[model samples]
Target chain A: MTSTATSGTTSPEPRGPRSPGRPRSERAEKAIIEATLELLGEHGYAALAIEAIAAKAGVGKTTIYRRWPNKEELVLDALAATSVPLGELPGTSLRDDLIACVEYVRRSRGSRSTRLFPLMMLEGLNNPRLRERYETVVLEPRREVLRGVLRRGIEAGELPPDFDVDLGVALIVGPILYLTKVWNVPDDQLPDDVAARIVDSVLDGIRARR
Target chain B: MTSTATSGTTSPEPRGPRSPGRPRSERAEKAIIEATLELLGEHGYAALAIEAIAAKAGVGKTTIYRRWPNKEELVLDALAATSVPLGELPGTSLRDDLIACVEYVRRSRGSRSTRLFPLMMLEGLNNPRLRERYETVVLEPRREVLRGVLRRGIEAGELPPDFDVDLGVALIVGPILYLTKVWNVPDDQLPDDVAARIVDSVLDGIRARR
Candidate 1:
């Protein structure tokens, strides 16, 4: 968890006014992020308060404020911490490439992520700043991996030359979002066959023998 | 909207309340619902408060509480108010039936609904109460309309009897939600072609030219 960076700098002396230090306590930062995610899941974004987060983390208000400019920024950092990183692009066929992403989401079901994500989305409604961070940290990184897979597909000519990269990205991401958000697929029953099914259906279409 | 029904009240004037000759004002009820929708659009659910809504509508807290039990319920009521009622089963083809639903959703964009729908989705994150209401109020009604259309198509032999109805429903709703939620399709540009393409793809799979 980037311990080298933390260990590189001697943990700073408590600063007066400006609060001099080698950045802040890495332990305190980790604790604060965990507390923020817990608070978000438990109380939701509307009820989540910075003072409560600081108190829960056993850090001062200034410590919390110094690290993150606003509650949204704090929440953004917390969300980034809890988010499941995009798994390595699977080195198999198109099927395996797709499975990697779906499995990654399936494994995240019971975690704080399930609850925190929607709250972050809710917060995004009013907070432009939160929306920006969400796009940058969680969303863009995921899209990049998907884009790589598409680039490979097009190069291999497995998919049509003119296949819409962006559309394919949506087609891949859409069913999972539909499953999690609207359909509320049960935790155990998330279809492992889903990615294969989507690729099949999207590439092939459902029409029967003429 | 339907104030009396939305309030969940036996009578407009409560037995516990004093001096209720004129009872509650329907004007105030409509105003409050309108204000809630407006604020939800302007500030979203997290920033939307009963107090803010009351101030906008020139009503007291008691008035809002009397009509709805809580913020969740109040939001649901306002959402229901804006939702285009899922009309009766269309006697047309499944494609036409789906087109009708898409058109209704498209027309609702930029009204109170486009803004409020996302908030309802956000609320469904952790609140089982809200989730149940979401399925019943928002998700099921729309899904059922599509389901019925598919059911009829199966019965009429237009579609295969063993065709996956649930998946068919997914096909219909999936792209629309993905379009709005992630892709940020312009409010005016619902892309009827996308809806048509989705319908064609779902019914006829996307195999390469013979």
Candidate 2:
């Protein structure tokens, strides 16, 4: 269910000409990504500097720049690491799939990475570069995964063929977002049952009225 | 439908012994509130300071401290100023009422004051004081207005007596917030028709399925 290419490819790779030196250090790359998320979670995007990320990652500044051309690119990759690929959910029906999706958010709502979402939204408000990267890197990819679920549901005859996919998607995802972000509902309380209710409610609208 | 009396009173007034020579200045009070909102919009709550607000308002620090005693109270008041009292929306049916409610958000979404919501959400995450004050001053009051509308809908036989009011509210408001804030869709593009669509979809599930 996860969109695979959505994460890594969107960043504008200003990767400078590679020097004929030691092969790219995967270990160093991993450290850098982890440190970037940690710092982003702690201080948000504006306060984040590549120099600080290099220090935290214990990699040289040159190595950091070699991989990601800018801070936006670096943060994009870091956020990508934190997100689960929307792989196929273990569900026989759209209702189950929807519950799985909501459960995924519920599980992650407490983590430092998830907590960074509010700050990410804050940073995106003022920074156009970060906002574009965020759409490509974070927002669009997640939306794509959900899009797939809805498309499949329609194909499987679980939903009406003529349903407005855009509005349907909003109806499905909107309340969960409201609960998590606006109401600040606790992670434990965002039950699978509520996800089921939302799915039923959305389906009632778009389902063929018998 | 806006909640009243949710602002102003929540703050603990550590009003120090007043100097008998001068009554509190209403002009200073107004300036302080305005300055707090301006700075909150520009720098966000994390960067906002009482000292900066006092300087911006051209009032003494003690004047601010006298009424609110802390930044949270000042911010709550500033946020309160931005929200309009829930005026009686002219509508007959529950669907009409719901549409009117959504239209209110649509109208205000582009304002400088409403734009502060994302920033306020970000600040509330780290600061419990602000979060509580926000709930009291901003979120709860707005919610109460919607609650009344929903209750009236139920009583009027427009919706099921046992309708999940909370979930219904979220469903109604969520997509609007998602569209306005998350997607940052253009103001002119957010049509009045959307309100009707959301109401129709919500009514489908909760309305007596005929």
Candidate 3:
């Protein structure tokens, strides 16, 4: 299938000499990203091939090449496309809001992510460009959202004015990540009330109150 | 050079007929495990070769084959040998005890661990035996220590009777693991007071007290 990039009405008409091919289309971009994720799950980083990605995507090899120089770049872009925005959670309290964020991560992480996320983390260590992009595009955005929530809570006097927001965020989210990745706890086996439990434990530490 | 595992006074005299050559020596076993860790640091899991490990350790390939069925098993054993026993920390308070544990991990994880930990985690996912040994030998032992500390804290009335000990342990250790591995944050860059701050954050949450 020869997928072509179609220019939407918002795209300005070509002012200069255009490439002798169809305009780029959002449909093809989404297809390529989805294909990259599927291939990553099945084959991992070492075996992922551009030709296979193009074939699975149902687009010409040139379509992928024009956008990404190599499989690493392609994979980075594919992951970035899946990054969720965490700005609009609806909850009556900080505890509920935190749970909402955890659920969002749970729901958004596809099966492919279960197998592929670790590979990307390992691969990113050796490759500087990939590491930077993984942090900036994939990690930092989600962290910023958490920060935003904490800041809001502090301002509303829901939290202490001197609260260490950064550490607060880490305490809230870190255990879930550790259990999932390090301990290899399957999602189903994870405690049903993990989010609530984490919030409670962190909010009121094991230390006895006066 | 070919090495052998020799029986010592510690080993009971062989009841059955033994091989003609010298018994497997404990010295050669230690050498081989050390070599495996060094190679893992330099080449990671995919490129690690049993032959190279044998050569580096100055033992015969047969020596490695006799003990471990494959590279993964050998690597797992090498890591297991390095797991620290956390039983003797001399801290006056639960907070001090937790920090000591954190410091012990920070000190014990060598450069090899920094390079090799992620590879082991990624490889362990597909290999169930390695994963099981990883949990039993490497992960669970450390987790058990944290459990012991929390239990001790509760017994002394340092913490509330109803405190969630399991979640408390996770909250204590999870952020450090997450920052080090997932974010790939350099050890030097981690705050010196991380343990104290985590302890504080969990004890008295960011939430403003009534």
Candidate 4:
């Protein structure tokens, strides 16, 4: 496996023979992550139990415990593995990049993992440890990706140098989240060009006039 | 007592000796509502139990049942009783009124009931009945209040006649919610002038400059 290949510095033939247990362990890990996500979507964070996850994954509790110390870490891994990365931006223009980010959010509305986001937030309200991990592991990375785009906009003189990047992120992200999470606007009901509309509206307010 | 007064059309004197059951029933109702809010804050919606609420309130389950048909309705009442209505707008300018609306949201940050909003939203995701009731009972009223403000702004020619009020509301409300709910920005960390900042930012985008 990749793990063995990366770890074997002195091995003459890294790919010669896979360990008998390696493939089964990898399958178990995937099953565990899938079960974690399914339970979270059905029940939510507080009600999620490690034993239940083991049962659903058809693995022993010790296998799950060996992989993740607790439910939070397991959940964090599941989210990280499943989350759609921002991917390569077109580098065309600020408006295009912003539209891409919003479109990413719009597309996530259909996924079960995306639906668990609010439940995770609810649990984070009470658990500081999980909250910190979630921020650093899941949320901050996504925000940084968007921040990079905004930074490019500023450097290129597409936006004012004094533009607040954090506020800009909130402005672009907030309305769509409100529509999907709070308003529970159905997918079919959402405008096809919502990403463009939001990006343009925010761009008009933030972009400096020539 | 108001219920008694409103229903006593045949009574010669509406203020005559109060029904003994009425005052005690009112007190029981108050206790139940308090317990509901407390448990909801502590455990969230999915974990909330009517039996537990009754136990906490020092009343029988039947007492709670008599007043509210189910946990959702009880929660709706508890939220309604505690929710801060947008009392009256200044009607001075679109900028001022929007600031007031945003300020209202800012002030709600300190309330326990306000904290339960995300939990309620999480529950609403799965339960269509609860979602509809929450929208009609709690969310719609607040949206309507903000909607009224936007309507006035359009009428006063401060905004374009074609202004998208729903979109305007989403733009103004979304960032603030994102800051408080998603980012979990602490109260002290949030600027005192956040309301003004958000309103001005959104107004600049939506309002038609002369």
For DockQ, the strongest prediction is 2
lDDT of 1 by residue, B1-210 (tens): 234334554336753432335345667777898899888777756678999999999998878877677777777777776776656646667778876665555555555565566566666664677778767765676677778888888898777777667766665667666766655567656544766666666566523322
Lowest lDDT sum, 10 consecutive residues, model 3 chain B, at B1-10
Candidate 4 wrong stretches, greater than 4 Å: A1-24, A208-210, B1-25, B42-49, B60-63, B207-210
Per-residue alpha-carbon lDDT of model 3 for B44-91, expressed as tens digits?
Answer: 667799899989999988767766666766787788675554558775
lDDT (C-alpha) at residue B108 in model 2: 76
Model 2, span A1-210: residue lDDT tens: 123212333335554333446355667877998999988877778789989999988988877766676788888877867775556787688888877776665556666556666677778778867877777877777777777788898899887787666677677777888888788877666654887777777777654243
**Candidate 1 at A63: error in angstroms?**
5.3
RMSD of 4: 5.6
lDDT of 4 by residue, A1-210 (tens): 122223423324333334566888779888998999999888778789988999999998877766566777789878877887667887899989999898888777766667777778778778878888888777888889899999999999888888778888988998888887788778778778877877777776554232
The top-ranked prediction according to lDDT is 4
DockQ for the candidates, in order: 0.34, 0.49, 0.38, 0.48
Error of 3 at A95 (Å): 2.3
Clash totals for all candidate models: 11, 8, 13, 0
Error of 2 at B209 (Å): 4.9
lDDT of 1 at A64: 72
